[model samples]
Target: MEAVAKLNNYPTSPRKMRLLADMIRGMEVEKALAQLEHNPKHPAVPLRKLVVSAISNWKQKNEGGDESTLIVKTIFVDGARTIKRMRPAPQGRGYRVRKRSNHVTVIVDTK
Candidate 1:
């Protein structure tokens, strides 16, 4: 059985989000949750919520199924549209600043 959850346009770079994603990529549901809970990274918060939502989705899809055996089957982050802004520079020129965003997907399945 599999369940999926997605977070879109999260205001964080894919590189940073991937760090957390990599940490819990193949971990068990319980262990992953614990790891997220203890992690200080900002991305960990949404990732943890996504995992919980995925687990809830699994439970809904398979009534009476146990969640203890669930593992994060796949989790990936992709780049989203970047917002560009101008920052004042010393030479009367505006430096382009890119505010990055990302989309994250999590797939959970029974181990």
Candidate 2:
């Protein structure tokens, strides 16, 4: 059985979030949370929270289950809506700036 958690419209680029997601994929749940907690990355904070939430969700779904055997089975980040803004440039020109967002899905399962 697997437990899944999703975070949508996260205000970070998919490329940046993928770096952290790749590290936790296939790792033990406890170890993954620890890594995210210690890592000095903006996205890691929310990722850790999502993992904790997933753990609780698993517990609620499966009564009398052991959490120690849980592992981060799959995690992925995908591009989401982009916010576009205009930045003032030299010579009275405007430059388009794209603020990217992403959605992340994490699935934890018993090993």
Candidate 3:
């Protein structure tokens, strides 16, 4: 059995989030949480929250499920949108700025 959780509109770029997600893929739930907790990257906070949400989903779906048996089967991050803005530059020129966002999904399943 598997359970999935998603974090939408996260204020980080997809490329950055994917790097953190890759580290925890196929890892046990507990270990993944620990790794995320200690990670120095700012993206770790959202990833940690996402993992916890996945665990909660697993528990809710399986009333008698043992958490110790669960593992992070897969994790993915995808680009959502880039909010475009204009910033004033030197010489009366305007520069385009893109603020990126991402969507993250994590799946957990029992061993």
Candidate 4:
């Protein structure tokens, strides 16, 4: 059995979030949470929260089952739409500004 969780519009860019997601791929649920909790990166907090959500999903899917048996089977981060705007520069010039967002998906499966 498998469960999935997603976090949309995360404040971090997809590139940055991908770095953290790569570290947790194919890891057990417990170890993934531990790594995220101890990591100093800004993206860890959101990733940790998503991991917890995925665990909850697993628990819900398998009633009365042990969460310890669940493992993170896949984690993926994708680029979302970027909000673009123009910033006025000196001497009547304008610069394009891009505000980035990301979508994160985590899937867990039980042994």
Give lDDT per model, in order: 0.95, 0.95, 0.93, 0.93
Candidate 4, residues 33-59: lDDT per residue as tens digits? Answer: 999999999999999999999999888
lDDT of 1 by residue, 31-99 (tens): 999999999999899999999999999999999998889999999999999999999999799999999
Clashing pairs in 1: none
Task: List residue ranges in candidate 1 displaced over 4 A.
Answer: none
Please tell me which model should have the higher TM-score, number 3 or number 4: 3
How many backbone collisions does model 4 have? 0
Arrange candidates by TM-score, highest first: which order?
A: 1, 2, 3, 4
Better of 1 and 3 by lDDT: 1
Alpha-carbon shift of residue 84 in model 3 (angstroms): 0.4
| Worst lDDT 10-window in candidate 4 | 63-72
Which stretches in model 2 have alpha-carbon errors above 4 Å? none
Q: Tens-digit lDDT track for model 3 on 3-90?
A: 9999999998899999999999999999999999999999999899999999999999999878998899989998998899999999
